[model samples]
Target: MADAPRSTPGREITTGERRRKAWANWSGAVRGIADSLLSPATTDELREIVLDDAARARGIGVVGSGHSYADLVAPAGRTLLDLRHHRGIDTVDPAAMTVTVRAGTTMRELNQELAAAGYALPNQSAIDEQTVAGVVATATHGSSPGLGTLSSHVVAARVLTADGRVRTVTRDDPELDGVRVHLGCLGVVLDLTFTVVPGHRLRKVVHRKPLPEVLADLGAFRDVHFGGFWWYPHTSQAIVWEASPTDEPPTPPPARPGALLSLLCNNSWTPRIAGAAHYAAAVAAGRGGARVLRRDDALLHHLPPPVQGTEYSVPFDRAADAIRALVGEVRRGGLRVSAPVDVRFTAADTGWLSPSRQSPTCHIGVTHPVSAHDPQGWIAPLRAADSVLWEFDGRPHWAKVHFRTGRELASRYPEWDRFQELRRTWDPDGVFLGAHLRRLFEH
Candidate 1:
């Protein structure tokens, strides 16, 4: 018999990591909630507060909008560094196609401000709930043909090191690659400067079709525009496409007040009921698809709240096969996947640990609705099949759910050592080390 995979050192090295088992993340997956939550408005202030706190307990975590459900921000018995008060956009350079913003600013706020200036992010992830700093820190992305993840837009960033100092670095600098997606372990992301495209009008075209035809011609279709697909479980059909215009007017989709109300009901009364209703609607419609026109702000990022999900990025070449197999695994395992399987594309970028690392990739994200009726035991079977993702050289989204440990994380990220080394150099006292950071890197 094969031996069980050795637990990574980071998992058990620190007292905080041990206590993390009890913290609760955004998903309602409770773990060890922090004893104290600190909101710091300035980099200098944060640096001082972190160092002083480290004297007693070195455990610490930096959080943005708390969009990630994974333990990414769950630090046990440690000081939680909330950057919301640090929100600010410092500069915008139209000629350079760049803008500098505070770590605490949400994508929603940032886009709105940028639009007022006729500038916008070139690539953005699906949701506006994420913080600019957090998104870049975790390499969050959206579906777009030949586009890179949000971090790739970064040209420079200011970091608050453990020793109560601030360091501003740029893409041309040698340390840039390591910091692009530093995961808050290396240093607190104080501010980031990113390249932006001129704000423009965008038109969306969403429709449904057979999965086979969509997959077969995906590349050609991808070439014509920026978009992707969402496949429903228990069916071979898919919501085939949504494309954005390069030079269209800013026309946003119709706000779904009804859906919002339903979501509120789910969260308030029966979470499962809300998800079930949404799922049934999609399934009954065979596919509910729509196209809307919106300003680049609305088109680039605006997904209604999602419970939580696991997102995997596989090389474009293996995407279709991997997705089909994943679909089968869901059926074989009998997992109730209420959320549509999201598929998005991106061209490779130079960011060392970015999911799009030097290769075109497709992001396939799967989700199960939150339920009070199901136990952790019910998820056991599906969790067992997560390795299917690794089999295809898939990298799990840093912000989503996954069972992989630090060793697995190290192997997946080529710049893992660089990030660790930076953390060591900047935070020798482990001022920024916490349960989440330890799990993903310390080991």
Candidate 2:
């Protein structure tokens, strides 16, 4: 009965028909096969599917850009809700400096639309491939000590719960924080309203510093307006990126070809992209050049292609020590890795499941892009970093690789018990939660 869903525009989507579908995240880290794939184009249709006895019996799962390194979105055997069709800007109120976007809208599409309308997000994650819903669901963050996680930008949300009621959660609601980063557990989000800012440009400055010097005083760089660093421990050098909001006229397309190749490229050859960028960066190091980029482009940096990585948010004060211990552990475990570790910072926020919850945090991300061709290579390093990160009270990013189960992670998050209570109250029958998510929360 849930198979004949139609789009909000009154046209039936071709993919709405029930069929066997194979699902895999980028980098092929997590994958599964779905028995039925459905794209409900409107909120009413989503509610219908939620209330349908057959659909409820089968269980429901949602997938957006499939970019997560964790097995968070693998909808094996569940009736998967493919959200690509249910995307667009529902409303943009320039006077209020806010935009209402459909849950399935990708950051790339929304960024373009926002720019066209003379506004933009306050900050964005490293890459723009994720859906805005996925960004909020995972508590995606940027490297600005002044900015909170993307979920913090949400002023309101519209979600469909298992009780077959469509609820609009706003700032005044007691459960707003719970809904902010629901991890696809609370319910099916229809759309969200985000607070936006006027369009602006950023000046990105580059500096190459010895890794030891950076480790000596990491706090000095934490206040950089909107920038972070790419650390190459093996080379003992770090590529420092310092970006600040600017009103100056933009610079011409990267003054040098090395800068251009290093910053922008075709996505086909993942490994070569890393090699070429690293070589160019190594050559351009310390020349201390600067370039101006649009706010969206400036927010995004080179995340080595074909990436499968793990990230943890630790107390800002202990981040330097955590990094030292992480590197020591990797060496102790003898895990061979080549991807530069990404270092960034974020302001604290109120989300119950947010990594930076109640703490001004420094995020250390260890990536192994080369392992995209061999996933087995990532496990050793991922496990190696866990103890060091946990010892320093690091909270793992929900959508990246981490080894913490619900019970293991409960003690770390201050609001863990509260989130569990809300999930239990909202989706008692577990219609929106699938097998993978059950393992994450119920275990």
Candidate 3:
């Protein structure tokens, strides 16, 4: 018989011993119990666990920063490979403008290290707390017609396959395209190498305008290096954000009132208070202001309150039409959304599973704070938006909430078959398959 699984380094539990604990994603949207949790500090230790027959007999899944609101990290009676302990800058090649880091390193840590070395990532998502591997796995992105998703920056990666072997993949490797956005199905990513650029500064300008005005001039938004906007539901006003490179000294970001307002909006004391808060916030932001900051600072925005939502990517040309239809549906349904609808853009990328694959895309996100009184009220609006986006051939973001199954998702991704082939080659025994992935791939 195979040896029993080990929960920690240098220690193994008895065959009769089994430990289980409840796990939930960041927003508390998805929760389940994990049979066992393993945090391996080194590649050798990770391989040892992967190779264990007893552990492989059960299921194994990897969990990163747990930022995803979806069930991507939901483990049910399976071992979860937590990579938090395996984090750091492994190597830096300044001449080649590349940095290799352990998969668990957070974007904030990586960006700070790169800044100290006079380098930075070409693009960044709003939140910096996600692990490097997690970001790339989900194809996390930012608003910029010139920059692709984070996965696009990965030139190479070292992944520990289900059979206990490390596979080093480079940009030239055809398999690399699928591995870049593996969705935790391919294998456990050990480390990643990303191409970087010289550190720079950005000037961010925020102003409010009628939604129609901005939508009419979508071309103007795309012309900037980075641009996006926030649309407050039940109102015609929207806050527009545009950024461009600048050499001027950095300025502090304006004080944000979102925190206090979000608290009042989500509080159980009065449900209608949330809608009022959003309106007030939108009105206040309509006033124009500008801030000059380091590229990292400008790219990383404040974390919103605990919320659950979905994001969908549509072709750039159909973005305005989709948004209009979504807004109209929300109004017709009379759904009360407590947060702004976020709109952003990303350049086309080659990642086989990326939402922006093959064409420039616009990402529209709708979020609502968890309500104590009417928790299920937000679902109608999200479903409504999902229907509108789907009509336009929208693809859902991997890390966000969505109800797409393998059959539906396969039709959206042209390289779905190729990704599945690579996944089988790396994890033939389904070692890394989780409940969510099973619904997405095996269904």
Off by over 4 Å in 3: 1-20, 256-258, 264-276, 372-377
Highest lDDT among the candidates is held by which one? 3
Stretches off by above 4 angstroms in model 1 are 1-24, 53-56, 246-252, 257-280, 283-292, 295-306, 375-378, 381-385
Q: What is the C-alpha RMSD of each candidate to the true structure, in Å?
A: 7.6, 4.3, 3.3
TM-score of 1: 0.85
Kindly list the per-residue Cα lDDT of model 1 for residues 154-184, writing each as its tens digit: 8999887776678889866978887887777
What lDDT does candidate 2 reach at residue 253? 43
Clash list (residue pairs), candidate 2: none
The models' CA-based lDDT, in order, is 0.68, 0.78, 0.82
Model 3: weakest 10-residue lDDT segment is 6-15
Arrange candidates, best lDDT first: 3, 2, 1
lDDT of 2 by residue, 210-247 (tens): 77788897887667888777775344567778888899
Give the Å shift of residue 180 in candidate 1.
Answer: 0.7
Clashes of each: 14, 0, 1
Models 1 onward score TM values of 0.85, 0.89, 0.93
Best by TM-score: 3
